[model samples]
Target chain A: MTQEAYRNRVKAAAPKSPLGKNIVMAFLFGGGICTVGQAFLNWYLSMGLPQKSASSYTSMTMVFLGALLTALHVYDRLAKHGGAGTLVPITGFANAVASPAMEFRAEGVVLGMSAKMFIIAGPVIVCGTLASIFCGLCYFVVR
Target chain B: MQTLFIKTPVTVEAHAAVVGKKEGEGPLRDCFDLVAEDIFFGENTFEKAESKFVSQAINLTLKKAGLKPDAIDLLFGGDLLNQCIGTSYGIRSFEIPFLGLYGACSTMAESLALASVTLSCGQISRAIAVTSSHYYSAERQYRFPIEYGGQRPPTAQWTVSGSGAVLLKNGGRGVRVTSVTIGKMLDFGITDANNMGPAMAPAFVDTLKTHLKDTHRKVSDYDLILSGDLGSFGMEMARELAKDEGIFLGENYADCGCLMFDLKRQDVHAGGSGCGCSATVFCGAILPELESGKYRRVLLISTGALMSPTAIQQGESICGIAHAVCFEGE
Candidate 1:
């Protein structure tokens, strides 16, 4: 079958997911994640930590939570129901790394788990670092 | 030339199936030989767990027939994983002469066809055909990370975590493998990996058409006609295609993937799709019904989408194949 014909038939036959429902669920779930981070930030502030330190601690805690959830296989369920909500946070990065490591663990330590850990998140890290470097250079030139 | 049916008949002496927790809770719970809640199955990794499933299935199947691994002349098996490692690693401990096959989700039928043909030709006294699929392992290899919180489209199917093995003897009181129709590669140029049912439906129709022609049989000749892993969407599409060919597949037609799980409750959008989908259903559910003489003649057509991550990445369209195995019960 030609690509056009297949695509037409597939589009007609594919199941239709409710976009409005998914959007609402995503909003609620994403907001819930952000609210949890806010709570962590507030808790750290109440303990007299500096704002900078508190923010960093909040991110660290969320990342840890993400990794833990992935290990326990709970994040997958959340992702299924929550959709982009689970992915639009620092937790998603942790999951992206941890999931590959867990999957490739069978291939042995060096080549499997360790090497492929960055398969998903490697591009994010490289681009993030590069953009930051470019901004830093711009700041120096302006100064 | 690619589509043909078996001539001489072979016998299925014994068969066994092992499934994961989720599958065990489904409608066909009693059909499975072993159902464990844990995906690990007392192993460290999901890969190991899958391998154990295959190994245990083979052993139990042999034991059910009162035969040892040494009694089997050859073992034919495969899995959804790359390199067909789930099958290779699983059967390695038994030290049986192995020939690994890869037909993605259609592996069960592929292996069964080969084993039946080999036995029918009198080349082997006994042969074992086995295949397995694990949800976790298949997910990581085919899609995103297990924890990636992306919403799957309704077309996507749940990969079943299960294994099935069948022991075929030269002759037995069990179901007789009457014929097999081997499929040719048919590419519908489907690119979406998530919707495999639509991609594979054409292949199923193609093989079914050829099988009917070669065997000089009509759809009504068989008591039941089954398809592997077409799920709900593909199953419907196949019927539509068959109707266009002036052959209507009525209620007797069922897709194993659609029957493997409860779609609404299981959250499997289209249905179940994996190597184990048809494998488990055939060994666990279908074979027993045949033994009970509830059905005299049955046709099993297993469909598979042949695509790799590399192939998809290279922008290649997904191709499909289906193998049809006909069985007659005494």
Candidate 2:
């Protein structure tokens, strides 16, 4: 068969990811993570912290939890079932950075762990920074 | 011209299979010679662990055959690691003449075919063919880090962490290598690295058809026709492709990948893959069945996708090749 024909055949035969199930799981898990962050914020607020300080502390707490779960090898299991739910949050970013670091740790500290720590998260940081700069320039000009 | 009929007997004297924890929990658990609970196999790194598996399999095979490493005329081996380090490092202590192979997942059959041909040519009296693959090693090299929380598609296959070895001699009371058909590299423009079944099915079909045509035998002539590491989807594709070419692969046809694990309980998605998938299944299950006179004739076609990470990144379609070996029982 022609390559085009074969490609079509393969496309037809390949099994697709369960979109509905994934969406539901993502919603539940993502919402659950957000709920936890809100709870942390509330607890910190009730402890007499300001709103801005409370939010920053909550973000830091979530990142620490993400990194800890990844180290314990639980985050990947959660992500397997949670899909985008675990991936769209700050915790997910922590996992994205920490997983590669743990994986390449056997190669050593500097070249292995630290260098590869940002392999997955590097692109995100670069694009996010660039986009923010662009938006900042636009805001400055309009203001 | 692709198929060669062995005039001199090339018999399988002994064989061994070593698998990791997950595969030990599989349906063929009882068939493996050694099922290591630790995937590390007592090594520091996964790569070293894979090498340990290869060596263990060879040692076990040698012990079973009651032959010293020096008695073996040649050793043919390979693995999925870069530069075939798994085979080289694993077999280094044996001090035997070695020729390494790199047929991707098809290394088992490629080595077997080459060993058989070399033995049949009367150049070697005793030879061993072995191949292995490790799940973690393969994953880190091919896909992502083990701890990476990325969801794999349903079409993805679990690489089998295992090794299989077989000893072949000029004459013996064991399974005989009757014929071999080397396949041509064929690309169907498949680009999805996750869906390897379809990427390799065409090559399996081509090699199977060529072997059948060359031997002038029908598919039913053999007691079993097994494809190496095609998994579920690829096996189905092979059946469909073979049907299109007027060849009906009946109930006797199966895939090593599908047989290597429990599809429902194992969560292996499509099924087990890698060089070890077919290698372990063939050594652990099929060889014993053939030895016990349960099967008279069997055909093994190990298919491989020959795309590297660089090639895939460059938007090059994956090309596949398969090697077919025919084994018969006395």
Candidate 3:
């Protein structure tokens, strides 16, 4: 078959997703995850932590919860339903690191899991650190 | 089109199926030879566990056929692993002349076709065709880890964590391997790794058309026209494509993947897939039906998507292939 004809056929036969429905799902599920984080932050504040510390502790809790859910095989279900909502959070980072580590764990702890654990998240971490350093340098120069 | 039929018939003397605990709980639970309580089968990793399935399947089939390792002239098998290491590592200790094959999920059909051809030539008296696939092992190799908690789309198929083997001889009293139609690779330019059913449907229909044309057979000729592991969506697409070619598959068509698991209860969205998808089903469900004279003549077409993580990463389209083997019994 000709490439052009084949491409046209595939386009016709392939199923299309509803963008409107997907956006609504993303908003609901994404908002749901953030609401849980907010509740955690409130709980930490009520337990005597300062506002800033409570916010930091909430992030930590969310990351821990993400990794735990990933380990329990629950987060994939959330991400599947919520799409980018689950992906655009600290929890996504936790899943990113935990996923590869668990996969490579069969290879061993030191070389397999430990070395390849940061494969997906390493770039984000490196870039985030470098961007913060650049911001700090800009502040110093302005001062 | 050239005839893909064998001149002399090959015989499937015996067969064996070894599945995981999850498969044991499925609809065909009682059909398998042994269902390992542990998915690992006493292996350290899921990879090794998969290898163990291949070895045990071969051993069990050989035993059922009442033959020793030396009685078999050749061992042809493969798996969904890189380099087909699962097949190699499993059959290594047996000292059999091994031909490691890779047709992805279509490997079992590929092996059977080659084995039958070799036997019909009168050179090899006996050959063993086997293939295996493991869920966790394939996931880690092709996708992310099971721990990733990634939600599977409805089109995604659950890879069967099992192994199946058939001992084929020159002539026997069991199911007769009448002929095999080798498949051609067809690329539809589909790039999505998750949706393989649509990508493979065209190739499957192409093979079915050619097989019918070459053999002068119709959809009604066989008791069943079985596709390997096209799952639910792919099977539907194949039927639609076949209908377009003026070949109505109708009630005679079924997919091993679709029949292997209960879609609703088992949580297998698109149905069971993988090399074991067809292999275990053939040895477990189909072969038994043939033996009981339920399906006198059946055409088994195993379909495969020939794409790797590297190829998909390089933005290459997935190509699909389907190999057909005719099994007849009195």
Candidate 4:
């Protein structure tokens, strides 16, 4: 009858163990995710990048660079794996910005296309913008 | 045919909760002004668990709406069931001309929009859009039972174990369905239905933008832009995200999902989900606020994810869709 009804029946018949499988699949993807994260660690090891410099570099570049790849629609493939894999920080923020930019494209320019696109990403940019400014002041003070 | 200069008049009436065959009705009973014995099981039908609760709720709502069998133009509803069997049974019992709608939490908004347009077009006169939910029965049947001790993430919300029904009329100077902002189910290709805030945010942004465009009203115009079930974390995320667009929904943008249970007492770290979340809030919270002149115009945005575990297993991305209904109180 209704799609909901059909889904309910299918869900009722769904194997319970599948949740166990999902749990395992979720973790397996996470493990793969960690190995990639380690590669960033390895970048420092291989390049002789400094400790504090490498850590900041890795995290910042990871988020900012991931934002770049995400806009190009490259990292979306890995996100399909679900959970911790997609949620591991850097890529998540990238997703935050790229999604709205893509959506607002259809509304043309006035408000929908220009203004609405930043709803989610807007906060990130605001915080990020302010944070950088604050950090600049601190850097000047310390220097 | 009746013509009003405002938004649609949709009232959630006749709310009743089953107190677990327990000692008392708890805060919910007091809030809805429902009597205890009003709950009764439908005989020879689906077991007394899910089916009975829904039927009892429907009858209560019907009574509150002052509706008789022949009076209800069309019965539009669905629940967590196969073929919306619970809704089917409710429809069968009342025998009102029926149309089943499934938008998960957004079902109430979806049905109201349809019912309102029908009334506005003279396709139907008096109509009812109803949705019922039961946490205990639904958890047992679909997801894990609470007793199962499943480790829920911060993203998850408690499914509201309640029922909500609204009666819409041809003439209510209070409100009319003026303009609707339709939303697309943005998956962002996410599959984790358990943590739905992010999945739902895209749809929320889309719908809110569309509503402003169609109605030509700024966010500040409406007193509230309430969502169905985005929990505490979801609310924060929505708030933080909305600010990025130079839009701030403010505290006026609360969600029904976050208010279903006393999360602290129930160990509901987040809030609630299901159709009942939005339904009860409309009847209990928003309606009262409106009636008291506390808020003039309100927008209820109910969001739902259009995905199943099977779809997830089949590697389908979880998509979220939201529909908005604007209601103004007299």
TM-score of chain A of each: 0.86, 0.96, 0.84, 0.55
Candidate 1 wrong stretches, greater than 4 Å: A43-51, A130-143, B1-7
Lowest-scoring 10 consecutive residues by lDDT in candidate 2 chain A?
Answer: A6-15
Candidate 4 chain B lDDT trough over 10 residues, lowest sum:
B18-27
Q: What would the per-residue lDDT of candidate 2 be over residues B1-330, giving only the tens digit for each residue?
A: 999988899999999999999999988999999998797989888999999999999999999988899999999999999999989999999999999999999999999999999999997799999999999999988988888787888889999999999999997677899999999999999998999998899999999999999999999899999999888889888998999999999999999989989998998999999999889999999999999999999999998989888899899999999999999999
Model 1: per-residue lDDT, tens digit, A71-108? 99898788887888888888888888998888787889
Docking quality level of the chain pair in candidate 3 = acceptable
Error of 2 at A67 (Å): 0.9
Q: Which candidate is the best by DockQ?
A: 2
Per-model DockQ against the true two-chain complex: 0.60, 0.82, 0.49, 0.01
Q: B1-330, model 4: which lDDT tens digit per residue?
A: 111222434433333333222112333445553323422332331224445555656677677666676887877777765466656665576778889888877887787777766776655667777776656545544453222213456566666655566667776555445555556776565566666665676677678877776676789899888888877766665675577666777767778776556666665556777776687667656766776778888888888877765677688866878888887766
Q: Candidate 3, after superposition: displacement of residue B23 in Å?
A: 2.2
lDDT of 1 by residue, B12-31 (tens): 88999999999998889999
Greater DockQ among 1 and 3 belongs to 1
Q: Rank the candidates by TM-score, best first.
A: 2, 1, 3, 4
- Name the runs in model 4 displaced over 4 angstroms: A1-143, B1-29, B33-48, B145-147
Evaluate model 4 with DockQ and give the value. Answer: 0.01
Docking class of 1: medium
lDDT of each: 0.89, 0.93, 0.88, 0.63
Could you give the fnat of all candidates in order? 0.73, 0.76, 0.52, 0.00
- Of the two candidates 2 and 4, the one with more favorable DockQ, higher being better, is 2
TM-score of each: 0.93, 0.98, 0.91, 0.63
